[model samples]
Target: MTNGARDENVTLEALCRGDVRTCARLLTRIERGEEAVIPLLQALYRAGGNGRVIGVTGPPGAGKSSLISCLIGAWRRRGLRVAVLAIDPSSPFTGGAVLGDRLRMVEHGCDDGVFIRSMASRGQLGGLARAAGDALTVLEAMPWDVILVETVGVGQNETDIMRHAAVVVLLQTPLGGDEVQAVKAGIIEIGDVYVVNKSDHPAADRTCRQLREMIARGSRLRPDRDWQPPVIKTQAHLGVGVAELVDAIDGCFAHQNADPEAARRYMSDRARHRIGEILRDRLDRRLRSGDEGWLEGSIEPVVSREKDPYTVVAEMLSRL
Candidate 1:
C-alpha cells in the first residue's frame, strides 16, 4: 500500500495529533525501507520538535528493560504521554527483533497514553539499528511528552546512542574496583547520569564509589558544560531508586534549559553528528546498491592493493 502513495492513508496531521494506528503503519513502512515516506519525513522534520528524547544505554544484563518498565509507570503517574523505541537484536535473515513490544506489556500494555515499539539492530556494532534515526524522527513528530530510546546492550564501540539522546543515562551492574577501572574510557564518558543497578548486591556501594571517583577524575565528552554526571544506585526490579533517576534526568534537562548557549552548543554538536550519520548511511547504501555494482566490482582491485584504500576512497568520493 506504501508503494508510491505516501499520502494514501497516513497524514502529518494524524501523526502530530498522536494517532496511534496511522503512526504505527508509517513506522512499519520506515522499517521496510520504503522510499515513499521520504517526503513525509521531510515535512515532519519541519513540523516536529515537540518531544523530549532521552536515551538509556548500558551493558547487557544491566536490567535496562526492567528499569525502563519502572520508568514508564513513573512517567504515566505524572500524567505524561510516553513512547518507547527499544532496539533489539536482529535475526540475520529477516532483520526482525528478538525483543521489543513484549518488554512493556506487564506495566503499560493497556495504557492509551503509552506507546512502545521495537526495531532490530540489523548487525550494527552499536546499540541502534540503521533505521533508528528515521524511526525516532517519526516518534518526535507525535504528541508524546517524553520519548524513551532503549538500545541493545552496548560497550565502548557504541557511541550512536549519544548522538540521538538529549540526555543520556548509563546503567551499570555492581562491579569491583578493577571492573570499574576498565570502563573509564569511551562508553563511560558519554553518560549524563550514571546509575548502578542491582544495588542490593554486596558490591553496589563499592561500584558507586568507584564510578564517582572516575567521574571526578575523567574529562567528559562535553567538558565545557557544568553538569556533573551523578552516580546513583538502584534496584530496578523492586522499583527502587527509579524516581530519583527520573529526577536526575529532569535535572539534566533543567541544566540545559537554563543555559541557552550551552544548550545550543550541545545541539549544534548533535546536529553535526546527525548529519554525518545520515551521510554515512546514504553512502553505504550507494556503495551497496548504486550504479553498476560498486562494492562488488571494486573488491578485487582494493584487496589486491593495486589501488590502496585511500585511493579507492578518493575515487568513490569523486563519484559521489
Candidate 2:
C-alpha cells in the first residue's frame, strides 16, 4: 500500500481504539467533505450500530443547548462516554456555523469522557448538516456509549433527524399559537419523547396537556400499535426534570432493544437513507464536473417554452 493509505489505516485504528485526536480529525475531514472521508467512513461503519444516537430538535428559542448540557451531565454521572454533534446555522458568507453550540457547552470542555463537535447546517433545510450521518458513523466507531445530535432549531423540515436517530426528542415550549401549529403540522409525529421545556412558565402545564392530546390522537392513526410517547415537562436551565427525561430516553432505548424486528427496521432504514445520500452526492459531483454546460444549454430552451423540463431531464439521463 501507498504511504498515505498506510497512514490513514493507522489513524483509523487509533480512532477505533479511542484516540480522541484522531477521532476529532476524522470528524473534521468528514465535515469538510473531503474525498478521502468515504474510505475512512466505510472502514468504520460496521464497528458502529452499538452506540445510542439521540436527536434533539425544536423551534428557535427552545433552549436545546441547555437541555443537551444537562443531558451530558446526567449521562456522565452514569459513567458513560458521550459525544455530541450540534448542528448550527451556517453563515451565508463563509458557509460556517454562525453560532456554535460549543460555547453553551463550555463546561464540558475539560471532561475527559465527553467529546463535542459543532457542525454548520450549510443551508440544508432539514436542520442537519449534509455530512451528519457520516459524522455519526465516525463517532460510533469510537468508544462512546451515547451520541447526542442537537439540530439547528428549524421549526419545520427537521424530520430528517428521524432517519439517523433511534430515539428523537422534540422540545416545545408554552409559546401557545405558532408553537402549537408547528406541533400539529408534523414534528409531533417524529418524536419518541416529547418534552415541554421551560416548564417553569405559567403555560407549561397547558402545553404538556396539548401535546399529550395530540400524541394520543396521532397514535391512533399509526398502523403499528407500539410505543406511546410520554410528554414530560422540564425547566432545562434550572436542571429540573432532566433526570426523568433521561429515564424516559433510557426506557425508549430499552423498549427498542426488546423488539428485535423494530431494531432491524430502524437499522435497515438508516442504511437505505445513507445509500441514497451517497448516490445523490455522487450524481451531483458528476454533474458539476462536466455536465454544467449541457445543463445550461438545455435550460434556455425550456425557459423559452421550446421544451419541458421533464423531457430535457430525460434526455440528459439518457445521455448519461
Candidate 3:
C-alpha cells in the first residue's frame, strides 16, 4: 500500500484498538510534522493514564541497557506486556549509534506481548521530555502493561528523563571524583531508586554508601515523609539484584499511590510538554518558511556584536 494509505489505516487502528505498528507510524508522522497526527495525539491525551512509565537512566556505559534487559525479563515472567523505548545516541557524522538496542532485544521481536522501539537522539538535547511523552502516548494506548524509557546517558538530560518516568532509576558506579560531579548534576536528587550497576566491581560497597549519604542529605533538604530512595547494587550482566530493583520500583508505585501529588505532577508535566511540542513545531515551521537568508543575514551582525541571539529571536518573532 502507498505510505499515505498505510498511515491512514494506522491512524484508524490506533484510535480504535491498541495497535503498536500503527502507533509507530503515527509517531513518525508526528515527528515529521504531519498535520494528520494532531487529532490523534489529542485523542491520546483524552485517553491518558493507561500505563505506568519507568525511566532507566545513568552515565554512559553504566550497564543501563543490561539492567533494563533484566528488568524486562523479570516483568515478562509476571506475564506483563512490556514496551521498551531505548533512546540511542546519534553519531555526529552519521546521526546514529554504534550500539543499536534492536539487536539485543531479540526476545521481544517475536512476542506479541512485547513491543520495542529504538529511537535515535536526533540532536535533541533537553527535548527527551517531549520524545518520551509522545512515545508513552503511543505505547499506553496499545496493549502494553508497562512502558520503559531508556535514555542516552548524560547529565542534564537525565533530569529530563525523570519528567517522563513514573519511577526514575538513576544508575551509577564506583568512580570517585568526576562520577560524583555527574550525579550532582541533579539526577541523584530526583531518583525514585538508585542503582549501582556493575556491582561485582570492587568499589560497589563504596558507591552504595556514597549514594546513601547523598540520599540522606537530600532527605534533610526536602523534609518530606515519603519513603527514602533506596540504593541497590546490581550486577546486571549476571542478573543479580534484578529482583530487588523490581521490588524497589514496585515500592515507588506503592508510594505514588499514597501520595497522589506525584501522579498529579506527572500528568501536569505531560500536558505542559504536549503544548510545548506543538508550539515548538509551529515556531520551527514558521522559521523554515520565512527566509533561508534569515540566519545567514544574522551571522555578520552577531560576529560584529551588533545583535545578540535574544535580539535576533525578538526580531524573528516580531516578523512572525
Candidate 4:
C-alpha cells in the first residue's frame, strides 16, 4: 500500500479506538467535501453500526440546545460516551454557521467522554447539512455509545433529516399557535419521543394536551402502530423532568432494539437516503465539471428565446 493509504488506515484505527483528535479530523474532512472523505467514510461505515443515532428536532426558540445539554449530562451519568452533531444555520453571505450550538455546550468541553461538533447547514433546506449522514458514519467509528444529532430548528422541514436517526425526539414549547399546528400536520408522526420543553410556561399543560390529542388521532388513523411516542414535559434549563425524558429516549431505543425487523427497516431507510444523496452529489460534481462554454452557450440561446429550455436541456443530456 502507498504511505498515504497506510497513514489513513492508522488514523481510522485510532478513531475506532476512541481517539477524539482523529475523529475530529475525519469530520472536518467530511464537512469540507475533500476527495479523501469518500474512502474515509466507507472505512468508518464498516467500523460503525454500533452507536445509537438519536435525532433531536423542533422549531426555532424551542430550547433544543438546552435540552441537548441536559441529555448529554444524563447519558454521561450512565457512564456512556456521547457525541453531538449540532446543525447550525449558515450565513448567506459567508456560508458560515451563524449560531454556534457548541457555545451552549461549554460545560462538556472538558469532559473527555463528551464530543461535540457544530456543522453548518450551508443553506440546505431540510434542516441538516448535506453531509450529515456521512458525518454520522464518521462518528459511528468512534467509541461513543450515543450520538445526538440536533437539526437547524426548521419546523416541519426538520422531519426529513430525522430519517437517519433510530430515535427521533421532537421538542416543542408552550409558544403554541402555528407551531403546534405544524406538528399536528406532519412532524408528529416522525417522532419516537415528544418533549414539551420549557414546561415551566403556564401554557405547557395545554400544549401537552394538544400534542396528546394529535398523537391519539394519528394512532387511530394507523391501526397497525408498533410504537407510540410519549410526550414528556421538561424544563430543560432547570434540568427539571430531564431524567424522565432520558428514560423515554432509552425506552424508545430499547423498543427498536427488541424488534429486529424495525431495526432493519430503519437501517435500510438510512442506506437508501445515503445512496440517493451520494448519487446527487456525484451528478452535481459531474455537471459542474462539464464544458462550461457549452453550458453557457446552451443557456444563452434559451434565455434569448431562440430555443426552449426543455429542448436545450434534452439536447445537452443527449450529448452527455
User: Evaluated with lDDT, which candidate comes out highest?
Assistant: 2
With candidate 1 superimposed using the best TM-score fit, by how many Å does residue 311's alpha carbon deviate from the native? 3.3
In TM-score terms, candidate 1 sits at: 0.91
What is the alpha-carbon lDDT for the whole of candidate 1? 0.83
Model 2, span 1-320: residue lDDT tens = 99878987897789778898888787788777788777777788866665899999988879889999999999999999999999988877887556658878878899999999888888777788888988888888888999999988867557889998889999988885544573566666798999999888888888888888888888888756388899989888789999999999999999988999888888899889989988987776766677788889988889999999999867866775
Error of 4 at 67 (Å): 0.7
lDDT minimum window of 10 residues, candidate 4: 176-185
| Highest-TM-score candidate | 2
List, residue by residue over 1-320, the lDDT tens digit for candidate 4.
99878987998889889898887877788778787667767777887877888899988889889889989999899899999999988888988667668888888989999999888988777789987888888888788999999999876545766678888899888885643484455665777798998888898988888888788777877664478889999988899999999989888888887888877877788889888888888776666675788788888778889889999767766765
Which order, best to worst by TM-score?
2, 4, 1, 3
Candidate 2 stretches with Cα past 4 Å from truth are: 92-96, 176-183
Q: Number of clashes in every candidate structure?
A: 0, 0, 0, 0
Question: Which of 2 and 3 is the better model by TM-score?
Answer: 2
Model 2 vs. true fold: TM: 0.94
Once fitted onto the true fold, the runs of candidate 3 whose alpha carbons sit more than 4 angstroms away are: 1-12, 127-130, 176-183
Tens-digit lDDT string for candidate 1 (1-320) = 66445464348878988999988898888877777788888888777777889999988778888898888899999999999998888887786656743464477889999998877788887789888888888888899999999978886668789889999999988863465564557787778999999999998988888888777776554568788899989998899999899999999999999999988987898889878977887787676564556656777888888877887778877886
Estimate the lDDT of model 4.
Answer: 0.83
